[model samples]
Target chain A: MDITDNKENMTEAPVLLSVRGLVKSFDGKTVLDGIDLDVRQGEVVVIVGPSGCGKSTLLRCINALEPIQGGEVLLDGQKIEKDGKNLTAIRQKIGMVFQSYDLFPHLTVLDNITLAPQKVQKRPRREAEEEAISLLKRVGLEGKAGSYPRELSGGQKQRVAIVRALILHPEVMLFDEVTAALDPEMVREVLDVILQLARQGRTMLIVTHEMQFARAIADRVIFLDEGHVLEDLPPERFFTEPGTERAKNFLHMFEFEAVR
Target chain B: MPDLGLNVLLKGKNMQRLLSGLWTAMRISLIAVAISMPLGILLGVLMTKKNPVVRAVLRVYLEFIRIMPQMVLLFLVFFGTTGAFGWNLSGELSSIIVFSLWGTAEMSDLVRGALISIPKHQYESSEALGLSRSQTFAYVIIPQTVRRLIPLSINLITRMIKTTSLVLMIGVVEVLKVAQQIIEANRMASPNAAFGIYLTVFLLYFIVCWPISMLARRLEKKWKD
Candidate 1:
């Protein structure tokens, strides 16, 4: 199989987010080590690896959700520091959707979406509710606004979570295995929303196990193994002809599973 | 057996003393609840802090209150303070202070449990949404904690009310104290007055606490649903 590299396309676009020599550890165990990458505006970067390979940790570190032992992250050329002044303001520009959805169980769906806008952004209640309603309608959840998180299916909850993050108008979106916890039947709807976002030219960093979905959406695919970025190539090259032996073995396992 | 005691109850000033005593008990408990709830909640949130020194201090205070009997605490505040500190505190004030201390400790534990019970994901999501620490607590953490705390706190309020009966030992003239006074006053005319007066005190306590217990149950059920 012949696969062309899109490295030229990446170099021409303006980078929206960048990571430099990122390192993270927990309880003296290194989870991410010497990671470096760039995500251009309108780029959809997908990260794939086996369990405990630090895919989620990298995303979390980028979002400043996890503390890093070393290195730095920049959003639109501004350094993102964990203890920096205006950290909350910095975080406002990045949105993250977790695997569990993590909707506030005590709140209605509409309230869940509007909370950050009204409270953090200082938007008027009426304005926030109006925007939330429209967002919900766009996601086909208009009638379910009054319902609780428990009242919604996994797909609906995940969609609501996406909407909740989107309402902030984040510069970049991070999806950490958003569909890993969803039922197989429900995964499509959530993924469909993400695809729609991708089509709209939104910058996204996604960690996923769905190889076909990664190929379908990723401009670039990063293969991480044991806290190292083994391969960073365009989707075609990463899939058809992985560079490192580790990448090749990883893809081989996936192909074997597909055949089985 | 009941004829003389019944007469004593209907007699002038006897019923009035009991009612006045009940009023005193109610007032002290309500005041303690009002004062202690907020203080307890603050202490409770502090209890969950990462600072070992602060947590250790709160833990010691909480454990001390839990293990020391309420009656003993009442005496310590009422008599010990008067002797050691020379403050000359009234029985009513002493009761309030003792109960408030106990209530604050209990409330803090409840608040801490409620706060800790909140899943870590909620805080992460709140932070990700750009909410500051205070904003997260106000909008997310506190609301859920309050819901979990209401039933338990209400039950504590009822316990405080009943425990105020100990104030009689300090000469507060609460219901039990009034019952003793009436029994003593009518010892010649009403030999069984003690039984009837004590029964009335028990009935009054039951009437006050039973409704509160029911309300707590109802709240627990409603919030769970």
Candidate 2:
């Protein structure tokens, strides 16, 4: 099978995020090694890997949630370390949707969505609420604005999480297996919202177990094994003709009938 | 002595003094709890930091507070501090200071335990949501900690109130102290008054502590359900 590279370096397609020569280790166990990646505007990049392959750590490093042992991360052409910008400012422009949908138990769904904007951004309450309501509507959770997290279904909670992230109007969204904790029947609803976001040209970095969604939505797919990117190709080639034997083997592990 | 009727007891000056002592004990307890709760929470957060040195220091502090009896702590703060430092402190102030210090350490340890007991995944999930550190603590971590801390803190409050009697040893003149004084005054006139006065002090402590104990239980049930 022929390798397909979907990376397009349009002059207008400025690099919105970049990671170069990234390395990290925990207790002398190297989890990421000499990695480089670039995410352009409006691109959806999906990372797939076997368990313990450092995909999550790589995503965490880009967000600056996990400290990087070496190398640099640039957001929107600005060097994160050299600029001395606070993580909060950088994080404000990056939304994250987690598999567990970590909604605040003390807050109503609307409060969860509006909290950071109202508190951190200092937006007026009415204006924040208005934006939150609209975002809630976008995620099909308008009815859940006043409900506590415990009152919502798992799917509804994840959708609320999406709206919560979107409320910040982030330039990039990171999804870490957002469907992993959902019931099988509820997975499609959350994935549908993600697919819609991708369609609207949101730059997304997804560390996902959902191969089908990755195939359908990713502009570029990266397969990782043993802390290294085994294959960086378009979905067609990534699924059909993975470059390294490690990628092939990693993909095979998910083929267990029970995993479906 | 046997048939001291309710009407007679209510009209007696002794009952009034006993009531005053009860009020004073309640005041001391409330003030101590109010002062200690926030300090406890701050120390609790500090205890959970990633630094082993900090954790070890906090652990030592917690064990020292836990192992030493409260009565001994009171003596150290009240008698020892005053004697050693030559600080002129009032009895009420000294009592509040000692209890607050003791309670703060205990409550802080409880808060630390509750905060650490939460699944690490909760924080990871919050981080995955791109929450700022403060947002992660305020929204995700603190709310959960508050629920767990409430019942335990109330338990501490109840313990504090009941233990305020220990302050009478240092002569703060709370309920138990008042009871001893009244018994002493009436010892020649009424032989059994000592037993009666001691019983009354016991009842006052029970009345003050029982409601708080019940509230803690109820909070546990509500959170569990």
**Winning candidate number (lDDT):** 1
Model 1 chain A: weakest 10-residue lDDT segment is A1-10
Summarize candidate 2's per-residue lDDT along B1-225 as a digit string, tens digits. Answer: 573222323435979888898888888888999988999888888898898998898788888878988889877877898789998777788889878888889998899899997777677656544456687888778888888889999999998898888888777888888878777766666656766677777888888788889999998877751
Task: State every prediction's TM-score relative to the real structure.
Answer: 0.90, 0.83
Compare the candidates by DockQ and give the number of the best one. 1
What are the candidates' C-alpha RMSDs? 3.3, 4.5
Standalone chain B TM-score for every prediction: 0.93, 0.90
lDDT of 1 by residue, A98-134 (tens): 9999999889998999999999999998999999999
Please provide the root mean square deviation of candidate 2 (C-alpha atoms, Å): 4.5
Model 2: chain A TM-score against the true structure: 0.92
Off by over 4 Å in 2: A1-12, A256-260, B1-12, B49-57, B74-94, B114-148, B170-172, B180-199, B210-225
> In candidate 2, residue B165 scores what lDDT?
87
Segments of candidate 1 deviating more than 4 angstroms? A1-11, A252-260, B1-7, B82-87, B187-195
